[model samples]
Target: MTCQLRVLGCSGGIGGDNRTTAFLLNQNILIDAGTGVADLQLHELRAIDHVFLTHAHLDHIACLPLLLDAVVGARTAPVYVHATEQTIQLLRSHIFNWLIWPDFTVIPSAERPSLIFVPHELGQVEQMGELSVTPLPAIHTVPAVSFLLSSKASSVVFSGDTIGGTDFWQVVNQVASLKALIIETAFADKEHAIADAAKHLCPSTLAKELKEWQGTAEVLITHLKPGESEVTIREVLELDHIHPIRRLLQGEIIEF
Candidate 1:
């Protein structure tokens, strides 16, 4: 079977056509349930069988509730949401509560509800259909994880919103057949204070983090803050790195 990873959104925040982080693996899997999912047609939404969230941040899971509401009746099985235990709880306590949104896990009936939370630990290689997904270490304000998605032929790692850590780079360094690294640099050098406070990355810190990566995969930067794209992009280019760096764009496709 052919394997494809499509970028539905990679922006730090939303405006105009820019959207928060989200990716589609083949047709049935989603990397995150961001606002970008709003663009998917009904048939496309119904095809989603699994959603892997990096964190419980609003930007990363903005569309999950709506996604379940849109596709619940169209499919026979509930959509599985895989994440760290903390993330799952936050989703339940904050986003999925009856006040904020009807808890889909009990919506129709608990026996055959529309959503299921599957908590996974770091480094667990979970199988979802044809792909093998492993969670990598991450340092963000809330509990978070980066994901390594591997098909038999090639692999890809997404460095969800984080201040890159030594363990993260160490694990990714050992991944073979890694084709791409979709990492984030969420702010400009001047706003690095904000980045550091939020545990996200800026060009300067991102450059420092890249030194730990000893992989050959092309680096695609994601999550640049809305109005500062031009300055951030320029700053990112001047950084020293072993691998080629490119800006991840919405609707971009990487076929491996």
Candidate 2:
């Protein structure tokens, strides 16, 4: 079995020629269908069978309607959407409420809905073919989650918009074979006010958060606002070079 990571969208928003936050696991397993799904080839896109969401943020969930529209009839199996119960409710009420967009869950047929909801508890580990996934809590405007993904060759964590907590670091320190991390730093030093209000990571704060980590995985940064990516990255890189740090790029394919 092939297990690889395809970054569909890595930016915080659909700005600066970048798409919003989204990722694909082994091409068929999706994580947060942000605007980046718009870029997938039609045939390749139709092959997706699962989508794991991080939160109810518009940037993270924006592409669900569009993606469903694209592959509605083409999918042979239902697209399993896994998330916390609250996240699912928000998506159903706010996003797919028929007023904002048609509720795909009730579409076509109730028994064979295009999108299938699978409510998962935090810290519960589930297997999808060759992938084993666990959800970790994240601090955000709404209840959010980061993902711990493990395959035979390696394991990694994706911090989906968090403010860095003890639980997060505890989990990171426990993973023995973590190969990389894709964490967020959304604003520049000058935008500290905005970052604070939104509870997002600034470069300086992110540097402090990294102190908790002891693993040797590449500390790849992501979710920078449109134009502030470079400055924010430089600031975070200023920290002591214990682990390799780099900025994540859109469409970059990472192999374990």
Candidate 3:
């Protein structure tokens, strides 16, 4: 079966139609439970069984607690939240500590809670039906990872909020069937300094990162700050050697 990925939200911030990062994999899995998750109807929200987080940043995890709260009573099984041990720990310490939000993992009863954290190490691959999700290295302010989603036919990589680094490309170049690369360029060229300070990518930094890329995957830029989307995309398009780059839009879907 061909796997499908739907962009639930991809903006760096929230305003008007803009939403934070979130992607729906097929119908049952979520790549990140950002504000975009709110766009899903109640029925669609209830169908999410697994969520793979890239990091613990609020923009990436903002809607997770709400999603669980909305669906806890509707589902029979716990919602599986997959992330690195560090990310999971941060969620446990900060987000789900019962003070900020109810700790759904132990809510109602510990014997059968509404949510479960599934810890995955870097480079580990988890099989979910026809999809293979592999955690890839990422450079960010906190413990983070990218994801390589592969089916039997093709694959795509989501570089979840990363800076320019060679570690991610090392694994990305090895993917024999890569079809697309969904990456972040959170700032415009003028904001390169802020991008560097925040460990995010601007157009210039993104160009530098692409130097290590060797695959034929179509490049789709994501996470552009809402107001500067056009400027960032224009800068990315003006990059000297990179070809066929496009801005990722909310509601877009990619099949593989």
Q: What TM-score fits each model?
A: 0.98, 0.96, 0.98
Question: Per-residue alpha-carbon lDDT of model 1 for 144-251, expressed as tens digits?
Answer: 999999988889999999998999999999999999998999999999889999999999899999998888789999999899988998899998556798899899
Q: How far is candidate 2 from the true structure (C-alpha RMSD, Å)?
A: 1.2
lDDT of 2 by residue, 114-231 (tens): 9889999889998988888899878888889999988988887999988878789988899877889889999988898899889899987888888888887898898988887888
Which pairs of residues collide in candidate 3? Answer: none
Q: Predict model 1's lDDT versus the native.
A: 0.92
TM-score computed on alpha carbons, candidate 1: 0.98
- The true-structure Cα RMSD of candidate 1 reads 0.9
Of candidates 3 and 2, the better by TM-score? 3
Model 1 residue 80 lDDT score:
95
